[model samples]
Target: MEASPTLKEQVSILEEQVGTYETVKSSLIEIEEESDVTEEDFSGITFYSDASVKLYDIDSAYINQLLGTYAIVRMSEKN
Candidate 1:
């Protein structure tokens, strides 16, 4: 017969997952901060998710510039 995980074991697993999630989330935030990408709540902007947000085709140069901020920020970077 297969033994099921105990409650404590389950909790430990969940806690580990939570810890990993926190690390990943903080890493993402750090990446954003380091890149100087100022992303305000998109909810406020009119046509933010509707008309303004492009899906498939985006400007490669702009994206590259945004990513480049991760290397060198402040000198030539903006939100």
Candidate 2:
């Protein structure tokens, strides 16, 4: 049988969310603010000379939980 993830493993996964946020936050392209995201953007979108923005498929609810975007539950998926 497969083993469940240990506490250390779970913590590592949680830590990765912070790294992901920082990486995107520091990027020059402000995806939603600068350009409209299309279905293609979800695959891979490029801008200007060299920046490429690809939307990775992570669960929106998980992201909301990680970022703590609300007082209770997720506000909306409209973003």
Candidate 3:
């Protein structure tokens, strides 16, 4: 039988994954900024779906708040 990873090993794996995610997120933000996309342009972006419920059709203010929270958390991880 294969041995499961220890607690420390699992933590190390998770940390690596987080680091990779942060790097990708940072790169995406940099690209968007360099592309001269305005905040309104970014926020107005939407996804189209044939389903009964459309996510983008919901309250945009809440979506912006969530995005702001995610940016803050990502920034905090740098320290």
Which is the leading candidate under TM-score?
3
lDDT of prediction 3: 0.80
Off by over 4 Å in 3: 1-56
TM-score of each: 0.24, 0.20, 0.29
- Pairs clashing in candidate 2? none
For 1-79, candidate 2 gives per-residue lDDT tens digits of 7656797698788797997878877896655656566555444654454346566799988988878856444556543
**Clashing pairs in model 1, backbone N/Cα/C closer than 3 A:** none
Off by over 4 Å in 2: 1-5, 28-79
Q: How many residue pairs clash in each candidate?
A: 0, 0, 0
Q: Give all candidates' CA lDDT scores.
A: 0.74, 0.70, 0.80
**TM-score of candidate 2 against the unseen true structure:** 0.20
Candidate that beats the other on lDDT, 2 or 3, i.e. the better one? 3
The regions of model 1 sitting more than 4 angstroms off are 1-6, 30-79
Considering only N, C-alpha and C atoms within 3 Å, which residue pairs clash in candidate 3? none
lDDT top scorer: 3
